[model samples]
Target: MLQLFKKYSVVIRFIAVFLGSYFLLSVLYNAYLIYSENQTEFYPDFFTNIVSRQSAAIMEFLGYSIKLEPHETESAVKVFVEGTFLVRVVEGCNSISVIILFVSFILSFFAKKRATFFYILAGIVFIYTINLIRIALLTIGIYEYPQYSAVMHDIVFPLIIYGTVIILWIFWVRVYSNLEKNESQV
Candidate 1:
């Protein structure tokens, strides 16, 4: 048992770190959601509110008239494009959960401290930007082709956003592996 544990220590560590960090971050995020719900300043929650506003801003910048109104009875923001109700921006649309998942996976591989920190920061920013674009494009797609709204919202947009994260993970793993190889050689 001792020998087996030693041999698989790396795997054990990775699993522990990944699960631990994911759980901690998720709990903290849930706490924030509860706190934000209690506060009157932010409708829904801070992150979702910001995401909705930013997405709307992106659409407006592209010359699409956009309007955002807080949902009266639910924790969501109603998004209208060109006076047409396109979609509702909800908590899941904010991308924080996605970022948390990305961070957890990256941290499991544990690389150089500074490199890891910067990579995580850059990854978060990239994910956030991509999410805003995804929302904006999705809204436009729905507005123009309401018949395909289900496919666009349920499949295409999710693939685009999650696909970006997967690509980032692949790149990070490749780079980390190369670094490990070089260090082993040295």
Candidate 2:
């Protein structure tokens, strides 16, 4: 038993740290979400609004007349293009949860302190920016090619986001996390 424990100690430590940090961060985030839902000054909503407004602005910049309005009852920002209603920018579409998950995964890898902090920040920005472009491009795709809306929304767009996270994870593990380095040393 003692020999087995010594042999697998690294694995055990990694699992414990990863699970513990993920759980702690997730719980805190969920609590914040709950609190935000009840308050007038909700931060998540702020991010949602930024996403909505930015997406709409991007569309308009690219010669499409777009309008973004707050939904009265749905707690979402409604998007309209050239008097034609498009999609609703919901909480899920805001990308906070995605960013949270990304951060959690990066934390699980357990990199150097400064590297981890900067990488997390950069990853958040990358994900958020990509999400904005994804929403905008998705809306444009629906407007231009309504026939492919279902395919794009249901499949391709999601793939882009998830694929980006996977790439980011690969980069982290191969570079900053140095898990490979530690493993190779063993």
Candidate 3:
């Protein structure tokens, strides 16, 4: 048992850090959700509201008329393009969860403190921007090609955002993380 543990120490450490951070962050996020639900200031939480508004603004800037309304009975925003109901911007569309996942993975790899902090910050911003673009593009796609809404929303857009995260992860592991140095030393 001890020999096996020693042999897989690095892998175990990565898993531990990843799971630990993910759980802690998720719990905190859930708590925030609960608190936000009780507040009257920002409907559907601040992050989701901001993301929805930003996405709507981006779509409007791209020559599409956009309308945003808080959901009647749900914690979401209804997004319309040219007065046509297109999609709802929910909490899941905000990208906070995705950022949490990305941060957890980066922390698991463990790099230089300053580098890690900046990388995580950059990653969060990139992900948030990508998510906003994703929402706008998805709305446009659905509007232009109503028949392929499922493929655009369920498959293509998700791939784009997640693919970006995966690319970032590869870049971090290859360039920023100390994994290579540690391996070489061994």
TM-score of each: 0.97, 0.86, 0.94
CA RMSD for every model?
A: 0.9, 2.8, 1.9
Top candidate (lDDT):
1
Clashing pairs in 2: none
| lDDT score for residue 180 of model 3 | 67
What is the Cα-based TM-score of model 3?
Answer: 0.94
Cα lDDT of model 2 by residue, 43-69, tens digit: 337778788988888888889999877
Ranked by TM-score from best down, the candidates are 1, 3, 2
| Cα lDDT of model 3 by residue, 17-47, tens digit | 9999999999999999998997666778999
Query: Lowest summed lDDT over 10 consecutive residues: which window, candidate 3?
Result: 175-184
Please report, as a residue range, the 10-residue window in candidate 1 with the lowest summed lDDT.
34-43
Give the higher-lDDT candidate: 2 or 3: 3
**Higher-ranked by lDDT: 1 or 3:** 1
Tens digits of per-residue lDDT for model 1 on 1-186?
999999999999999999999999999999988888876666788899999999999988989999988888889999989998778999999999999999999999878899899999999999999999999999988988999999999999999999999999999999999889988999
The per-residue C-alpha lDDT of model 3 at residue 29 equals 99
